[model samples]
Target: MATVAATKPAETPDEQTLREDLAAAYRLVAHFGWDELIFTHLSVRIPGPDHQFLINPLGLLFEEITASSLVKIDLQGRPVGDNTQPVNPAGFVIHSAVHAAREDAQCVMHLHTVAGTAVAAQRDGLLPLSQNALLGWDDLAYHDYEGLAVETGEKERLVADLGTHNLMILRNHGLLTVGATVADAFVRLFILQRACEMQVAAQAGGADLIHQSDAMGHKVAAQGRAAFAAGAGLSWAALRRKLDRLDPGYRA
Candidate 1:
């Protein structure tokens, strides 16, 4: 059997480490072509009672995000500490709602990928047309798009739409996923994105799509539960290694 990398350290990570992880997620999103220029955002909540989180600074592309450059901000979306980097208001509005509402949502990733938005536009939303789709089938939620997500009032509706689910498709907007860790959230987004891509490709052929029955959905869910029991640490480790080879600047 091949050896795998460790998922995380034994001790709780400090703010700096969290910054690096979130930065890696940004770079990975860019690397995978999921980034929409300087739009869309990924954030991780700081472990404290102040309801703080780290997000990409405005006006920078995803590839430009670095650990040291991540801006820490308060719940009201004000930059914390001496960091003067301005954050995207839309990013804060969406991310803050999740961080404040759900304790398990330590990390939240939202993207405006072509396939993701395409699926969101479809009446059926994400279909169980592929294996990756099954991974999120059980935990999926849907939120109707409310303009650009800049209003504070949208936070209440966004949280209400997200509810208890970790995976969400912001209708006619894009994809969103939350997790207990950065790795978990990234992996969930990966699955959701790939599923959307596959669905779009399959639909283009104009062929009748194969839909998995409810029984198969349950079976895949069980198998996924067993297979990913160790969580997304190993996958994250491999991706980090790949990033190290490609561009390790995010760690800076």
Candidate 2:
């Protein structure tokens, strides 16, 4: 069985900070062309024992999501307050499963990108075909597709498939990633998505692809874990600056 390097918890950001960070993530997803017409979801768990989290309001594009516009919801995916913003049912099923089951997974991100879904459709899953793939090679997990994720029973299977890994390719569905913070999850999804893109491009060429040795792959995976453990916040800060230049409305 594979294991992910455990991440030490950083000081918990207040609810406002988490909202801003998640809002920034939604914008970044759109900025990178990862949004699927607002079909996918990104969520961050709020601190305290209430098990509440924030998600994008339904019917809004990723670019249009702002910190104040996010909706706070409970583990059952129901809104916690008088906020009546529509929530995505599928998003609730997928994200609530992770947030409820994993204490380490403070933030969860799921996406339906062309390359990610294409790779998920393959029987072989993500190959160690690129440095990006190798970065998450050992940490990757897969959940067999069970049609649309609106069914609540699928939560058990989803958590089982995800196990301890932070990076997952939902077989025949899309990609899912979790982290101790929004930055951790987003950085992981970025790596996993890039790997899928590289795999798709390489396979399209119809040429023999080089496979790295398991020993070397492990080495690279360890290097990646260390880099993320050290710099996820730094990467996310830089990304936030980029978002600031692009459209700072997400912080509103």
Candidate 3:
């Protein structure tokens, strides 16, 4: 019989927190059924200047992930430590491009959720039809799909397409969001995903849509920013608690 290898020890506090947050995000996505069979990705920046980032191991379902199982990799898409698990190179390419080009992107999330992809395929793409859509008004960018996003040469174009936007609709593909913190990114994705779902459902009803004016959109977006800021701390704390209640094993 083959012998089992020894497992690694527990993570340090800082690393532990990062892992827990990342794992929680994964679980949250999984709970919502947004995960695409390990095809999508959510990445958090490492705290140091080593330019390392953490991502989910390729074979594990999002719900199966624990804090210790997240893999750390350099900006160049190379594994930073002794992570025996493989990563999805295509997903890494998209993430690495953003991380390398955008210093502000501390966490990057990409998803192929049904609603998001449905919106991406629409000609207008994320219409300003709802309050949630306003959160991305003038803030959402678009990047035309270029195959599977695995080419190193695509990084430049991807960055160019993203520009200064915090959210992007990967045209004919899916959605992407970046933030200064994990909570920020996750929240942005949540709003964007909801907006997409609402749009698709509204379109299915065959009712004429009411589009918000640019001024109204901007005003609502500013309010959203304030609201998000005012409640973010508590909200994140609550979200972490929810994760703990559901699966305290993530912290391990």
Per-candidate TM-score against the hidden true structure: 0.93, 0.93, 0.93
Please give the lDDT score for candidate 2: 0.89
Q: Which residues of candidate 1, in runs, are more than 4 Å off?
A: 1-13, 229-231
lDDT of 1 by residue, 1-252 (tens): 112221222124587789889999999999999998888999999898888888887778888888877777888888776666677889989999999999989999999999999999999998889999887667899999789999999899999988998999999999999999999999889989999999999999998879999788878877886766376889999999999999898887
Give the clashing residue pairs of candidate 1, or none: none
After superposition of all CA atoms, the RMSD between model 1 and the true structure is 6.4
Model 3: residues with Cα > 4 Å off, grouped in runs: 1-12
Better candidate by TM-score, 1 or 2: 2
Clashes of each: 0, 0, 0
* Model 1 Cα shift for residue 209 (angstroms): 1.6
Error of 2 at 130 (Å): 0.7
RMSD (Cα, Å) for all candidates, in order, is 6.4, 7.3, 2.6
Model 2, 85-158: lDDT tens per residue? 77899999999999999999999999999999999999999998899999997899999989999999999999
Cα-based lDDT for every prediction: 0.87, 0.89, 0.85
